[model samples]
Target: MKAIVIETVKPGGYSIINADDPLVLSVQEGARGETIMFSLDPDNPSLKDNLKKGNMNVTCRDENIIIQKGGWTSIVAKVNEIPITYNGKAPFNIQNAMAAVAATSALGLNEKQIRAGLVSFSPSIGLSPGRMNVIDLDYFKAVIDYGHNPGAIKATGELLPHLSVGRKLRMAAGTGNRRDEDIIEFGVILSRYYDHVVVTETDPRGRPIGVVANLVKQGLLKGGLSEKQISMISDVRVATDTILNMARKGDLVVLQADDVHFIIEYVMEYKNIKKRQLSKEVVNDDHSKEGGQNAG
Candidate 1:
């Protein structure tokens, strides 16, 4: 199998880096019809204007992508019949998947194999965890997500209600100071969804927990959440424990942390710290490779 690294650039964007130049393929039968919209690379300060003006030269290098407009929407593949669609834009997850499909096809995977590769894939943390499992209750629909940035939070918050109907969504959010303003803006945006909102500490390293929590609360308040709708907590363990205890069965529990492994470990440690009985499986992300298990 050829090595291909698909990087998550944003909520709905990714950059595919191929170590070796692969043969491009043409479009073929049974193509999934999904219209995509894309713009010039956001990272390039100049490309946006260049692309808008209909003139730019883009290439893939340095673990990033460079693109100009007006190119055909197809690739020459290892398989003669199938070609991967090149949309100007696609969902970050879908883009990542496409990169994999393209790489696999280049590595001699047939259409059936490429299709199977795409079908067998699922979302993981870092880009988007995709859909989180939450129950439906009389009060609200609870969801848990790993969205820490403003864009991620705003998108998730807005998208929450569309998942189910007839209920207001609650959000519990916090983040570090390096991205505090952005996180605050995200909270402000999320406050619009409030039946309720809680601003709590999330991985508050080298920063005052109280200060961070307050910042998030203030932003949400600024965003239009009633004062009574928001609360601040400095400790995530206590915060989550309290939220989980009070949240109705159907209410969502969204945990936004920068490091997924750390959150998993923290949850486990919190349980053990509280003297709860350890279940049959408990393994950190790395330890799991050694057959370690994490039982909830």
Candidate 2:
């Protein structure tokens, strides 16, 4: 059995320390001498040379990762066909899909099975909780992800422009246990990407109340985000409600939190109430029109 290794991802490049990272080394050693390597297009020479010396197969040089083995080359699946990649708008997910396809191919799954699996797969709260779970409502869109660190936040930011959101809102908080500097870094990244931000508190881990929230606010201010663009609400539920209330049609809200189930339930209830109100308004308008016609 051959193990596939993803050597790099878009926007951020290599996520690990380097190609020779301990995890990479351990995987390479434990694969029973069979391994498959995936690298970014235009191929990293060092990684290519290393894998070549180890007699491992490699995929390189294309938007659709091309895998080669025994003088045969083939693509696993088109990026647009995979729902998780959002039609290739999400580059990170493209890499992920490619990695999955590579592994399945190594396991002797035919192209038809691999393609069928990729197209049928969908990413949602139920399927992949806290990992880019997106919910689209009639009026707006919401993304709930477990993006806590600076790098993760940056990656999330890269996906914003692709969403075609009119106004971006972020529901964010700092963990009580993280360093103040790191918490501030989160704000700085948010300031760069979001149009409006609501800062709140999570479990707090162990830090005093208001400590982490204040630090995040300070970072937003330092990043040149006006106080008008920022709002501080300590309660998670209230903060979620406030941000949703602020959102308008075609807007996007990204919530970085520990639990998104409550927020999702709240949004569903809000949408139901809106639907009922809209139905009543339509009925009233029709009645008024009928009465006017009868009087005339």
Candidate 3:
């Protein structure tokens, strides 16, 4: 559930750990004396054989948690514990930290209570929402998701089709700068659910937005969604409006807007139209009755 890429190690001098069974060990990493500990799973069990070896490349469970001179090993703590601060003091990313705080609050802790729990806590991963935009003009349901990673995209692909039984699902996506290829793989995973795909500009700090969209398109094609199903659009408003306009009353139009204001606007508009139509119909009926009486 965690992804980490380790640095600070040289090539070929380390032994990778390959656990015969991943569940047997209660601890993911073993600690040794103050300076040098087994920072990774012992690959081939021969790492005990070559203790004095220098930096080496280590991989386990598809993660690059290499063993090296530095003391760092990615782990998922089994229970509640203070977070491990990286580089001694820098704080966790804002989104990730907020998510952690929210999680603690969900467990019935109040604001004062949760802050007390954060005295020594820190997080190792960054959390962010995925790109959400419309993909097709021809479809009715506008599909948007928070599938920014490969596993998330795979889950969405498997799950979204059932949600689209009576509607078409449109999609839009792009890659992030930090993990472009990983996100591209996510796009490929989405092709199964998406009726159309739009490659759009995503946030990249100083990187060209168009370049990121291209990478997403490339990955989408690999998932078997065709070029016809994909296009490029920069304006999210236009993309969302296109779907909203096409939606009928019974069809759902999902978009980002002020929830309270949107409800007020829709109710006012609908009520006004209904009142006017009913008033006209009543006047016509009264006129018809008067004309009939005069004729009689």
Candidate 4:
């Protein structure tokens, strides 16, 4: 599919390539246009080779996104300033932001214009829905994303440390028709970063009810997680509720799901429930104090 798409590039047109992905770079060999490459590392061999050959390149270094043309390099924007990168903790989003910069530059946008766009581009549900919407509630934080694919799961694993939380958990599930290996890979990838996993049966289309959850457990074990760290639930909504309730103050819950809108609504529901519970607790405590004073 990629090779076919690259074949459509008109001669002398512009192509933005990810210098870090070897497969993505390989398909560009047949591209009939100028290749503009982007990467997280400026010193990446492919990006370096491109720089030597005078191909336009963009990369993040020293916490800044830099664009290179032949012998010159210019800073475009600070990675921390980009909302989608999660203060430079999310390398995948940084790479994504770099891709946007490279493509916009190809469109002849100036540096000032590009910087403005970068700062304004938010990772909100209203903007890039299900991409990377971090919800900071009164207690725990939830990372909302639709990254269920293998590559995305690995990226999410990498993003764990950057969250700086004491414990990390996720609402996990597998697609119905995919191979068992693929489903297991989800558990393997997530187990590396998340301390606990709540496996849910989201679709399971035709297969048995617990098949997906079972396969994900196998992967989690293979990835070195213990059985105690895993929880298998039959319903996605119930799993979401369980995970949210399981989280304590300073704990992080990963809410990456294919149906992002539904998952987000669940988060909001949990938030409202917590708020009401807190309000009731406060009123009860005040009444108890008044009763103690009357007895005195």
**Tens digits of lDDT, candidate 4, 56-80:** 9999889999899987888999999
Q: Write the per-residue lDDT of candidate 1 for residues 1-296, one digit (tens) a residue.
A: 12121222334332333211222111211112211212223344333443454442232323233233455222212221211111212233333444565445444565566665544433333323323423333344445456666655655555555455444444355656457686567667777765666566665667865766777777887888788777666566666565544555345555554445555555445445544332323434356656545442
Displacement of the residue 264 alpha carbon in candidate 2, Å: 2.3
For 139-175, candidate 3 gives per-residue lDDT tens digits of: 3334334445565455445534433454333435454
Q: What local lDDT does model 2 show for residue 184?
A: 86
Model 4 scores a C-alpha lDDT of 0.86
- Candidate 1 vs candidate 3: the lDDT winner is 1
Instruction: Mark the regions of model 4 whose C-alpha exceeds 4 Å error after superposition.
Output: 52-54
Order of quality (lDDT): 4, 2, 1, 3
The true-versus-predicted C-alpha distance at residue 221 of model 4, in Å, is 2.0
Two-way TM-score contest, 2 vs 3, winner = 2
Q: lDDT values of the candidates?
A: 0.47, 0.73, 0.43, 0.86
How do the predictions measure up, each by TM-score?
0.52, 0.82, 0.41, 0.91
* TM-score of structure candidate 1: 0.52
Q: Which ten residues in a row have the lowest lDDT in candidate 3?
A: 124-133
lDDT of 2 by residue, 74-193 (tens): 666667778888877876676666667656766678778888888888877777777787777668887888877887788778988888558999999987888889888878878998
Q: In lDDT terms, which candidate is top?
A: 4
Number of clashes in model 4?
0
